[model samples]
Target: MLYLKSIGTPLVLVMALFALGGCEQAEKSAQQMLNQAAESAKQAIDKTNEAAQQALSEATGSEKTDKEDSKDADGQKI
Candidate 1:
């Protein structure tokens, strides 16, 4: 009984420290994962917007006019 009593206090302290450390590490890892997912989603949205704009300009025949306006007959800016 005496030996058990002497060992119990240190055992409990060690277990509590492990629990707290594990919780802190898990939270940091989860936050990093969330940040990466948000960045990927933002990139996807930008690409989708660019594709939609290109499609619209092509459909309306504005793509050719845009090319023409970029230069004069001598291949210089107008």
Candidate 2:
């Protein structure tokens, strides 16, 4: 009985420390995953914004050039 009592307390303490360390590692991993997801989302938004701006410019540029080419009888562009 004396030998069991002497060993049991230290064994329980070691197991408790191991469990706490595992929990800490899991928390760190979860945080890293969240950070990566946020970065990907930001990149996606930037790409979408660039595409929308390019489409808008392409749609509007031709009409502007045509208007500039057409001149009035007074030799001035209307």
Candidate 3:
């Protein structure tokens, strides 16, 4: 009984240490994954904004051309 008691405490401590180490590694991995997801979301938002601006510019340009076509050389409306 004395021998078992002496060894059991050390064994329990080693197992606890291993468990804590594993938990720390898992936390780091989860954080890395979250960072990657956020970056991807930012890139998508940037692309969407660029496309919206391009569409707006094209629409504005077409409106100007249409107005010019409706006017005569003297700047009067046909």
Listed in order, each prediction's TM-score against the native is 0.49, 0.56, 0.68
Candidate 1 whole-model C-alpha lDDT, 0 to 1: 0.67
User: Candidate 2, residue 38: CA error in Å?
Assistant: 0.7
**lDDT of all predictions:** 0.67, 0.67, 0.71
lDDT of 1 by residue, 1-78 (tens): 334234354455445555677677655665555566567668889999999999997877886778778998898977
Comparing candidate 2 with candidate 3, which one achieves the higher lDDT? 3
Tens digit of lDDT per residue, candidate 3, span 1-78? Answer: 334234354445445555677677656655565566567668889999999999999999999999999999999999
Q: Top lDDT: which candidate number? A: 3
What are the per-residue Cα lDDT tens digits for candidate 2 across 36-74? 656766888999999999999988997787876797768
Pairs that collide in candidate 3 are: none
RMSD of each: 17.1, 17.0, 16.5
Better of 1 and 3 by TM-score: 3
Clashes per model (N, Cα, C within 3 A)? 0, 0, 0
